[model samples]
Target: MNRYERTRVLVGGDPGVAQAIAAEIEEICEVEVLDAPREELVMVKVRESARNSLFYLGEALMCSCRVRIADAMGFGYVLGSKRNAAYNLALIDAAFSSGEEFERMPKWEERIEKEAKRQRDKRAKNRALIERTRVDFSTMDGDA
Candidate 1:
């Protein structure tokens, strides 16, 4: 998966995926925390539909961290104050960016792909359930 999809899965999927990857990475590589997990506020930007102009939606609290694995540097930023998740993401990022090859890389990627599939299935099921309850108001008489 690409970086965006990978991060989305890690952040939105089961938290255990990142933890497992981080654990494996720690066993082989020395993790150096360049920046500890810290909570901060970031301006949320959005586009104005009428004028097609950019504006700040608001400020959101985000947790971020930086780490180094061998010579490669990795950064993790996620919404909310999830310190552990942020740190675990940093480790996972470092593992992917580092030059060192991992024997378990294939397995890790498989797990992530599976999680992505599961999430997609869940959303589809939910949409189907909601669709079943949808009301066709146009077909109803005004008296009713």
Candidate 2:
């Protein structure tokens, strides 16, 4: 998976997956904390559908961190003040950046892919449930 997809899965899925992978990498390689986990505000931008224009929705609290594994640099950011999660995310990113070291972590990618699929299945199920509850107001309306 690409970085965006990988990050999304890591952030939304099981936190233990990221922690375990990071711990394994730390034991096998040298990890330098370039930037420790810290909280910050990032502007949320959205498009105004009616006007077809963009605007800032508001600022959202976020946690971010940076680290270096071997020679590759990695960064991670997540909504809210999840310091440990952000740190672990950065470590995982660094592992992926190094390429060769990431290969040594057996089944990590498979685990991530599986989590992504689970999320998709969950969303589909929720959508189906919501669809069943949808009311057909148009059909009940009288001709005027």
Candidate 3:
């Protein structure tokens, strides 16, 4: 299997800090950062086996970003900023530890089944509608 996979990391807030973190991660893993703070929290995307080690490293990186922001711009300034840092952290934690609870195969299968049923129902309804709308214009012309 390939050892490395392409990934992108979006870091919000200060450009310098975001760039620094991006550079650090780029050394060992592929990374890209978009230094826009319009939304709350930063988003990092990576494909490293989806294993514990990679998860922990991601978590650690988030923590580092938090600390770096806090140190540079005071605690209260960034305490409740627009970023979804907290959510990202929690998501990483869940993804790492949720085990069978977070497995998405069942959900995906259910979604597919529901969509298929919907399509079948729609087709049946359309067929009925078309049949009802069919014209007996030929017979009408002969009688007229």
Question: TM-score for all predictions?
Answer: 0.91, 0.88, 0.26
Candidate 3 lDDT over residue span 1-144, tens digit each: 010100011222223333333333234322222232232333444557756343322321223222122112211112244244432322222222333333443443343345446556887999999999999876776654
Q: What is candidate 1's lDDT per residue for 32-101, written digit by digit as tens?
A: 9999999999999999999999999999999999999989998899999999999999998888888677
TM-score of 1: 0.91
Candidate order (TM-score): 1, 2, 3
Q: List the residue pairs that clash in candidate 1.
A: none
Cα error, residue 140 of model 1, in Å, equals 5.5
State the lDDT at 127 in candidate 1. Answer: 100
Q: Indicate which candidate wins on lDDT.
A: 1
* Error of model 3, residue 132, in angstroms: 1.0
lDDT of 2 by residue, 1-144 (tens): 988899999999889888887788888879899999999999999999999999999999999999998788889898999998999999888888787745556688888888899989999999999999999987995976
- Weakest 10 consecutive residues of candidate 2 by summed lDDT: 97-106
The clash count for each model shown is: 0, 0, 6
The collision pairs in model 2 are none
